[model samples]
Target: MINNHMLKRKLDWDYRQRCIYMTTVTVEKRRPLLGQLTGGLGNPTVELSDVGIMVAQCWQEIPTHVPGVSLLEWQVMPDHFHGIIFVQAPQEKPLGAIVGAFKAHSTSLYRAGARQEAHLWSPGYQDTILLHRGQLANMRAYIQDNPRRLAVKRAHPELFRIIRNISACGHIFAAIGNHFLLDAPVKRQVQISRSVPPDALAAAEADLLAAALHGAVLVSPCISPGEKQIARAALQAALPLIVILENGFPPLYKPPKSYFDACAAGRLLMLAPWPHHTDRRSLTREQCLALNRFATQIAQEDHTP
Candidate 1:
């Protein structure tokens, strides 16, 4: 039988595979020690403090000390660091070990400079393994735009607040960046974009709305006209919805008149994985398809029976 402790621990997957890795380390208590965010909305940058510069140096030196690990890209934020490390070949140590070493070295330097005995980083960093080329590209964009996203969030704290670990309806969701993950007990359904004939859009929209009205959470990027129609219907019916956005929420995101009622009723959740792009535009085919896949995955995680 799996013990509770074992069940709670994340599986130690083999880290020798050639793949892209994304990781984030936050400062304990989320103090803005590493850098300061500067600039206006859509043009924010991080000005590294003395400690921040040291942190960056430690991260840059990782490749020299760790075999088979290449630093692809990295961004230093106010209280955290986001980096993409690629494992080019099998290494003697795991990816976690490499990260641990970097964290220890950076923390040591920070403590010595600050002349304090407190922890620098919060325990246990967050990591994601990119399994596909498309994911790699998307993650690369996300990391590169971290500074700009932080700026947008600061400009509009009301919409971009990182509501961490929210529990709703027996599910725990990590609402961070612009995306949300429904950890378990997910109820999922798929509505393909541009798949419905123009004449059938009304009926398809009604069907989707009916699913949500019946307690099936509607999940989508809501990009297609038909999908948007369904989203509007869900709002009108006061049904719960999980919307995936192509861009980050605008500063002080006030829902449009159409969505205001639903949002007020606590029946809407908007999610996005990308930074806010000031030049808002239509979604690319790849982005539309990727978000649809993510919706399906969320639905599949629903184990409620």
Candidate 2:
């Protein structure tokens, strides 16, 4: 089994910029790599030359329905596949939607022929949006060198270049066309407000505030002068404040600090359910829920005594 390290960088979803992204997906174990990779030295058991070709075509077709898109370097590894998918923001769908389409269509084909209900691939995939020039080059190099790293010395890299062109940055390269993909709609900046009774609002606010303080990046809900004061205090203490307001109402006031990162140590909290700590830190969802339940049980017992 391969030992993987804990992923470090957290991607801030930018809804306004279209960016090039690299996605790594893996196949189910006990399945031969032959079907995934083909035309390489040291033949794989389940030669997927046909499947890889089909997927490559699918990657190209993605841009037709989705605007501002292109395919860069891609390879089908024995147990995994790495591909650079480009997306121009403000297009037809989210990046996840694109991945889902690939996964769904490919799985259907694999299932119908394989006649096995076993998982076709792993559930989680890794995606990184190229935020800067250095990162973009790194992603392209990674995809291009995958053949050599996988010990396929006989493979030719140029065969995989379905698209390539010169970049205006004075460097010619293969990247999903230049366009900033908008951040897809996600649950961020939650609001709790005056629509509810002030008392309930306070309680809900406290719950959300507590959740954020305990590691949620929730902004404050109210924009009142008092709320802004509270936000200022929380930032001073290095707590991330979730800016909130009653539904459809502008913030009555803005907080003193304009920069959120300056308030915290660049620590962004993960979004999770109640009793669910964000997975941003090391703890898993199960571990978080279990520990909380256990603590609650002990507290209940002490109260009875």
Candidate 3:
């Protein structure tokens, strides 16, 4: 039988595989000793400190130290690093061992150099197994834009701050981005089915865009393709939007670039009724119904005092 602890944390996959992985290794106690985020809004970059430089150098040497593992890309931030590692050939060492060795070596260097901290990194790095097409491109773009995104979030902290105990409609949710968008007088749920044809979807999206232009907040789970289209249109139009997510917000969660831009513009709100989790899960039928119902309830109820 699988233990609860294993269920919560383990991926249940053979670690020795030729797989591509995206990993995030954070600094101990979330310190910003890695580097300073510098430059203007249009052109932001990380000015790596001595510690940050050492971390980058160690990361670059991973391929040399770990057999059959090669580096794809990496970005060093104020408190953490995001990197993509390609295991082109199966190695005796698992991903965890590889990351562990990297951390151990980095700590040894820190100590040898007489750094104040006993260790450089926190325990247990987070890894995402890249299994789908286009995911690599997306992750690469995400890694590339970390500096700029961090700059935007820092500049507009109010828009991206997580606000809890947000009572909307009949339910309560934790939220991020433009909470005042909740108070908008008019809101409509974008409920487009998967069966919707392309032409029909375009027409429906157009109608929703018209409503959004007339000061309406478009709420959606963004489940189906049509729903995604509608949400994308609303975002492109720079109108108010409310998205009901299946999973709750992670503590250090930052919205992706597209959503980040909308949040920075004070036009987006992501609502989550569930607690945060790390496990990858499929959307069950029950979850779909609940989210759709939640979206409808949010749209119908008035949030204004």
Candidate 4:
């Protein structure tokens, strides 16, 4: 006999264990105080490597302080920080207490510096638990690229364009430098030396599709961390055997309805391996075509122009 309020609280509190989480903690003024420490533009100037090390150290400190909690990679941006904490609900202290302790420790250390200014962080924080595997990768990218997101917002000004458009085009798209993936083995293979214009993109895509079509199984890792560039690239190329590794839940093979929607709507088609089907190499080109046709039919039936 759980009351409504207790049931709701239980539902919320149940997000522990391998439940990947994303937390964005901003500064008091969004002052880019984190940048002062990691952006290479601040007074005491903190290098990105140094920030990474500091975050790692903080992560290590958690198990000792709160027990049953493990730290994951995080990014310190100009104005905020994004981190993931793995909480083992069985043995860990309350999540709120753990977060507060971590924040207090970091804020104390940050403010103790000789150049200490206003409060190190804004009030409270934001958190989302990863119930699905794809969300894990999405959260990783969200944390690492907070600064890039800010830049895009400031430079573009029109947030609407960013929200509506999903394709990659122009020089800015080509000039991106990615090292988000830990231990990049195939990065050199994917780097494009020249700027490709929109008009010629389709021709290039056809060529890419032809090249990748022969493979029985194609594994396409999302851009290091969770950057969507590689996924977007694969979508643009219309590669048939493509698979996207989303969060840690194993690769979801069947592309989400939203992903297929983009393809049917004349945008790029970013297909991945369907989930629960382990033997990907078993999928033949004919099966791929059949799946694609089915996806098209579904999209046409449900999606509006």
Worst ten in a row by lDDT for model 1: 1-10
Write model 2 residue lDDT over 1-305, tens digit each, in one string: 32131121245685235778888766656354335444455643224566555655665677676667777767665566778876655655666677777777777776776687646666656677677868777777666655444432224322121123422122232211111100111112333333556776566556655655665443333333445444555556665533321211111111122321331233222111122121345545564444333323322232121
> What TM-score does candidate 2 get on C-alpha atoms?
0.42
Which candidate tops lDDT?
3
User: Native-vs-model 3 lDDT?
Assistant: 0.86
Local accuracy by lDDT, each model? 0.69, 0.46, 0.86, 0.43
Q: Could you tell me the TM-score of candidate 4?
A: 0.43
- Please give the range of 10 consecutive residues that has the lowest summed lDDT in model 4: 169-178
Q: Any idea what lDDT model 4 has?
A: 0.43
TM-score of each: 0.58, 0.42, 0.91, 0.43
The residue-level lDDT of candidate 4 at 146 comes to 49
Q: For model 1, how does the per-residue alpha-carbon lDDT over 88-114 read when each residue is reduced to its tens digit? A: 988777777888899999989888887
lDDT of 4 by residue, 90-183 (tens): 5444455666677777777666663565366666666666678677777676555545444433443332121212222110111011111112
Given candidate 2, what's the lDDT at residue 56? Answer: 58
Stretches off by above 4 angstroms in model 3 are: 1-10, 115-117, 303-305
Better structure of 2 and 4 per lDDT: 2
**Which of 2 and 3 is ahead in TM-score?**
3
TM-score of 1: 0.58
